[model samples]
Structure formats: structure tokens, C-alpha cells
Target: METFITYVSQNGFYIWEEFYRHFLMAAYGVLFASIISIPVGILIARYGKLSSWVLTFGSIIQTIPVLGFMAITMVAMGLGTTTVITTVFFYSLLPIIQNTYVGIKGVDSTVTSAAYASGMTRLQLLTKVELPLAVSVIMAGIRTALVVGIGIVAIGTFVGAGGLGAIIVRGTNATDGTAIILAGAIPTALMAIVADLVMGKIERKLNPVNKTATA
Candidate 1:
């Protein structure tokens, strides 16, 4: 604990900069992924035939090793934050996509039928009803993706992308740098835990079931 405090005290500025960078990369990745994945998820839910193909592709992307995935992305974009962000975006897709699909699909059929019976168009049903009800589930997916993104971008240090991982890696190269490693790792873990809790709270708030009960 003493060594850890000493390193953090000495390198406070550097750690802060990297920690900030690390968070931004994760936030950006999750933001970009949510933008696209939510729509794709809705599309798949409407067209069940496409769900298998779309989800399968996402699964394939998720299965790729981060290093290998980054390597391939680097071929087109080269080493940098952009490459890391793109990699983060891709890595984040599966959970959000899968969750979106499941959320929309999981919506009560009777509720949807009532909406359609009231003369709602497909788009109206989706935007006004389905999406609203699925917001909680979709938020859960985004929460999961952001947490996952935090972990993925940690590998960003190797790709010349600065993040907390850089500090952790520095500790690894030292004769006894456990303190340094913990300095970086503790923040990363904390970020994930904090994100999950905050997002989970938001998720519960948005849940229709919760709203109904509260009412």
C-alpha cells in the first residue's frame, strides 16, 4: 500500500491523463456502438429471418482475440486511438445487438397487438411503443458494452494508444512494479464497477415493470 501510494503520488498527473484518456476511449466506443447496434437490433427484431445472420456476425466479431482484431483493423487504419476506438466499437457490438434483439423480442405480444389494433404503423409501433418498453433492456446492454470497452481499451497501450494499461504495462516490465500495476488496474476496475452500478440504476428506472409497480 505504501509503494502504491508513493507511485501514485509521484505520477499523479501522468496517471490522471491516462485514466482520462482511457475513459474517453471507452465512452466513445460504447456511444458509437449503441448508435448503430440499437437500430440493427430493431431491424432484426422486425425481420426475424435476419436475426440469425446479424447476431452470428456479431458473435464472430466478439470471438476474435483483441490483439488479432486490432492487428486487422491496423492494416486499414494503422496504430492510434482511432484504431483502438474502432476495435472497441466492434467489440461492443455483440452485447448491445443481442440485448436489443432480446429486449424488443421480449416485449409482451399482447401489448404489441393492442398497439397494432389501434391502427399504429410499423414505425409508430416501434418508435412509440416497442423501443420505449425495451429501453431498460437496451440500456443494460449499453452498460455491459461500456464495461467491456473499458477492459478492451486497456490493451490499447500496446497499439500506441494511451490508457491506464500503459501504466500497468510499465509496472509489468519492472523488477517489482506491483504497486504501479495496481495503480492502473484499480482505477480500471473501479470505472467498470461504477459504470455498471450507475447504468444499472438507470436501467431499473426505465423498466416499464418498475414504473408500473411504482405507480
Candidate 2:
């Protein structure tokens, strides 16, 4: 406890900066993954036939060892934040993409039929009806990706991408580094918890079922 307290007092600034770096790395990764995955998911949902192949490809990427992926990526991108961000971006895709595909597919057929009956075009039905109804499920997927990104960002340190992982790496290298490891681990865990909780609230708000229940 005393050592932990001392470490905190001494390294508070470093912790804050690293935490921010970790956040930026995770945020950019999740943001980019969400941007790409959601659209791809939509396309898959629309086509249906492509869903299996597209998701299988994403699953294959996820199955690759993270360290090996980083090592391979480093050969192309070199060791830096860019490599980390790109790797993390890939890591985040599956959840968001899968969720988005499921969400769009799960939208009520009756609602889509009504939209068509009302003279809505396919594009209009998607944008105005399907997407809106699927918002909650999509948000849930994003939340999952966000948490995954947070955990994975720590590994960024291996490729010279600075983050809370640096603290853990340092601790592992040091003779008495438990305090340092705890310092990083605690905050990273806290950040993931906070993100999950906040995103959960947002997901609930987006859920039409919840709204109807409240009404």
C-alpha cells in the first residue's frame, strides 16, 4: 500500500499523460473500425448472400494472434502509433460489424413493408426506418468494440506506441514492479468500466423498446 501510494504520488503526471495516449489510441481505432464496419455491415445486410463470406473474413482476422499481427504490421507500417492504431482497428471490427449486421437483419419485416407501401424507396426505408430501429443493437456492438479496444491498446507499447501498457512493461522488466503494474492495470480497467456503463446508458436510450416501456 505504501509503495503503491508513493508510486502514485511520484508518477501521477506520467499516468495522466499515458492514460490520455491510451485513450486516443483506443478512440481512433474504435472510431475508424466503426466507420468502416458499420457500412460494410449494412452492405452485407442488404445483399444477404455476402454476409457469410464477409463475416468469415473478419473472424479470420480476429483469430490471428495479436502479437503476430502486430509483428506483421510492423513490417509494413513500422513500429509506431500508426501500426498500433491500425492493428487495434482490425481488432475492433468483428463485434461492431457483426452487431450491425444482426441489428439491420433483425429489424421488423412489417416496418419495412409499411415503408415500401408508403412509397418509400429502398434507400429511404434503410435510412429512415431500418437504421433508426437498429440503433440500439448497433450501439451495443460499438460499446463492445470500445471495450475491446481499451484492453488491446495496452499492447500498443510493444511497438513503441505509448500507453498504460508501458507501465506494465516497465513493471515486468523491473525487480519490484507490482505497484507499477497495478497502477496501469487499475486505471485501464476503470476506463473500460466507465465506457461500458456510459455506452450502456446510450444504448438503452436508443432502444425503442425501452422508450415504449417508459411511455
TM-scores for all candidates: the values are 0.96, 0.97
**How high is the CA lDDT of each candidate model?**
0.94, 0.92
Q: In TM-score terms, which candidate is top?
A: 2
Model 2 ranges with Cα > 4 A deviation: none
lDDT of 1 at 126: 92
Model 1, 76-177: lDDT tens digits are 998889999999999899899999999999999999999999999999999999999999999999999999999999999988998999999999999999
Error of 1 at 79 (Å): 1.3
lDDT value for model 1: 0.94
Q: Which residue pairs in model 1 clash with each other?
A: none
How do the residues 90-191 of candidate 2 rate in per-residue lDDT, one tens digit apiece?
988888999999999999899899899999999999899999999999999999988988888889899999899999899888899999999899999999
Per-residue lDDT, model 2, residue 80, is 83
| RMSD for each of the candidates | 1.1, 1.0
Local distance difference test, candidate 2: 0.92
Looking at candidate 1, what is the lDDT of residue 182? 99
lDDT of 1 at 91: 88
Per model, state how many residue pairs clash.
0, 0
